[model samples]
Target: MGRVLFVTPPLTGHVNPAVGVAAALTARGHQVAWAGRPEIIRRLAGDGADVFPCAVPRRLPERDASLKGPAAFRFLWEEFLIPLAEAMAPGVRAAIGRFRPQVVVADQQAIAGGLVADGLGLPWITSATTSAELVDRLAGTPKVAAWLDELLDGLRSRIDGGPADPRMSPHGVLAFTTRELLGPATVPHQVRLVGPSIGGRAPTCDFPWDRLDPAVPTVFVTLGTTNADAAGDFLRAAARGLSRIDGIRTVIADPGRAVGPMGDTVLVVPHVPQMAVLARVDAVVCHGGYNTVCESLWHGVPLVVAPIRDDQPIVAGQVVDAGAGVRLRFGRAKPDRIAAAVTRVLDDPGYRSAAEKVGASFRAAGGAAAAADHLEALLSG
Candidate 1:
């Protein structure tokens, strides 16, 4: 059996997909382990997982919450990405040495994985959890693009042993999205669309499955785990809007418990088994993170997307462009607006059809199993 090591940051969104891919490899008789935050790996990969400890620095506080465009990109790279790569370098090397993995599957955001593997002359593949980075959000901003290139180049030089292609691996890059949702765009030669790696045993959460009425339309709402925005207002608007609509039941995944108890029509919990909820729900109301977006469509569920920031707007655009969902202004959308969007998606047959269409493409793309095949081919070649 070949040994495989996965390097990823501590984020839930990134680690979850890796769990699926690793599971696929393990099922095929390959030994797989992870190098990341032990807590995150253990939580997602189960308590018995073999995980190498890595030190990730505390995120540098954002100078301003509303920073957008170049400023937002600057804050991400300068304060977080660069520092994260530097902090993770030693651990990445240590993991590689100890594991002696035949191939390293690294998350696109974890630059240390790609660079350190390059440094040590080991084969590696990129595990792209979010498709946001695949599209160029900075098309019109030439200066910002040039500046980012130079910044990344400098970071690569500092890391020093081998060639760096940012988050992508020259050997193979696995993107967990299909072009049917992404729209036509220029992609690097290395990236392969393997659909969303939707595996892993579902997390146990106190979900009211019995209470979910199969009669009325059910909407699952969440801003995702990493969205730092205050969701109380938007979630409240969702509750007010959906509850007022005669037959709709709203389940909001509010981690902060920010939203007050709305009546029996709406369920408010700090968390929900999102995959389980998504399976039963008719539609989704969310912040448009790629994981939620892809997963919802994977289950043939349409959405009412309210993009908060970062690559959210782009993802929302993809949903809209593909006719699978409707987009609303996250900050300014009123209760009525939220209601109307939900109603439209539920009532319109076109949105559901589009969602199912994308789901078909996702299934055909082969997901994690295909990703493993591609990775194994790297070994054979």
Candidate 2:
């Protein structure tokens, strides 16, 4: 039996997909463990999970809409991603020594895991949580791209423990998104598009399932777990939008207390059993987080995507381009405009059909189990 080590960032979206794949590996009689912040890993992976502690930098609230294009990319890599890699490398190396895994599965965002594993002469796979790598927009800007390349080189120079390794591993890469939704692209031969690795997510909140009315169509609205502060006004606008509609109910996951005073038409809660809600909802209104969009589309639910920052605009564009949803301006979207968009998606069968088509692709792409098969194959070879 092969022992697989999952090195991930502390963020929930990055860690969740690996959880599913890890579960599949465990079921196949392989030993599985994680290296990241203990609190996050434990909460998602369970208390009994073999977790190697890694120090994570405290991320301050970031909702800077002013930082655009190359500047945003630089800020993300320099301020967050690179720092995370450097902080995690020591722990990753230590875990490699102790856990003695056959392979390392590093999240696409957790660059240190791949770098350190390369240093240790171990085979590692890139666990891409999103499809952005296949079609990165930064490739268009020569100066910015060259600067970013130099930045990565500098990171590797300072932190490189051994021979050079591509930031994305050449051995194998597990992409959780299917090409059907992301469209045609130049994907490496080693990269496997294994759909969304949505395993049994341990529910954080006990949802009021009884509160949901079957008579009315419901829209599940969320900004995911991370963007509470940035999405406050938008969430409030969505709540108001849904509230004004007749014979429709909306469930808003208000983790940051963003929405105030909900009526019978709107249910405001700190956390929701998102999978459960997704199963029952007619449509989704969310910031274009890849996980939420994919999960929603996986359930054949259409979306009204309001992009905020980072890869969200790209994700929103994908949603619109795929005809699976409507895209709205985050800061500029008024309650009336949100309501109209939601109405359009709900009323139009075309959007629903498009969402179902994407959902079918996701289902056929063979999620976690297929990902496990791919990983196991890499080890065998």
Candidate 3:
């Protein structure tokens, strides 16, 4: 049995998918372990998961909500990704020495895994929790892409590693999306569009399941984990907009407690069992986080996507291009616009049809099982 080590960041979206893949590997009689933030890995992968501790910045101050476009991209790489890679380099190396796995499954955002593994002459595969990087969002912006290359070069030098693109592994990439959503975007040969790794996440907080009314149209609204600070206004707008429509229930995830109070018709909470809720909802309204968008589509639920920053616009574009949802301006969307988008998605059957089509493709792509198959192939090859 091959020993597989998954190296992920502390982010829930990234780790959640890896959890599913690791579980698949374990079920196949292969040994699997994790190297990341122990607290988060344990929470999402269950306390029994074999995990090695890693260090993150003591305090990662939230990004300015107004930052967008190129600025946001630069900030993500410089402020978060680079620092995170550097901070994690030692832990990743130590984990490699201790766990001594034959293969490493590295989260695209967690470059340290690739860098450290490359330095130690071990094979690594990218666990692409999101499909944004796989399609090359920077293809049009040569200068921006060049700038990023330089930054990565500097990061590699700091970690004393040879040249290599940490984002894409030469061995393989387990992309959590498929061509159905990606449209005609040119994908690299090494990428395996294995669909979203949906299950195997340790159960999260409970929801008020009884509050959901099957008679009324239900819309699940969320901005995902990282965007809570920027989500307050959008969540309020969504609630107001959904309220304007009669016989519609809105379930909003307000992780930051941005929304104060709401009536029984609108359920506001700090968090929701997202996957469980998606199964019951008629529609979704979200910030277009790839994971959330993919999960919603997995359940054949249409969406109203308001993209904020960092691959969200690219993901939102895919959703619109696929005819699965409507896009709204994150900052300028008022209640009327929000309501209008939701109304269009909820009333029009075409959106749901598109989402169901995408969902069908996802199921056929084999999800985590296919991802594990590819991993085993890598070892055999």
RMSD for each of the candidates: 1.6, 1.5, 1.1
Residue 85 in model 3: lDDT: 91
| Consecutive 10-residue window with the lowest summed lDDT within model 3 | 156-165
Model 1 Cα lDDT, one tens digit per residue, 32-135: 98889998888888887889988887664644547766677788888888888888888888999999998998898888898889878899998878778876
Return model 2's CA RMSD, one decimal.
Answer: 1.5
lDDT of 3 by residue, 208-265 (tens): 8899988888989999998876988889988888887898999999989988777888
TM-score of each: 0.96, 0.96, 0.98
- Ten-residue region with minimum lDDT total, candidate 1: 58-67
Write one digit per residue (lDDT tens) for candidate 2, span 1-381. 899999999899999899999999999999998899988987887778899988776663374756666677788887888878778888988898999999999988888888888877898999989887755566668888787777778777787754444446888888898876888777777788999988655666698888898888999989998776577888888888889999898999998997897888899999887888899999999989999999999999999998877888888988898899999988888999999999999999999999999999998988999999988997897
Candidate whose lDDT is highest: 3
The candidate scoring highest on TM-score is 3
> Which residue ranges in model 2 land beyond 4 Å of their true spot?
58-65, 162-167
Residue pairs in candidate 1 whose N, alpha carbon or C atoms collide under 3 angstroms: none
Candidate 1 versus the native: TM-score? 0.96
* TM-score of candidate 2 to 2 decimals: 0.96
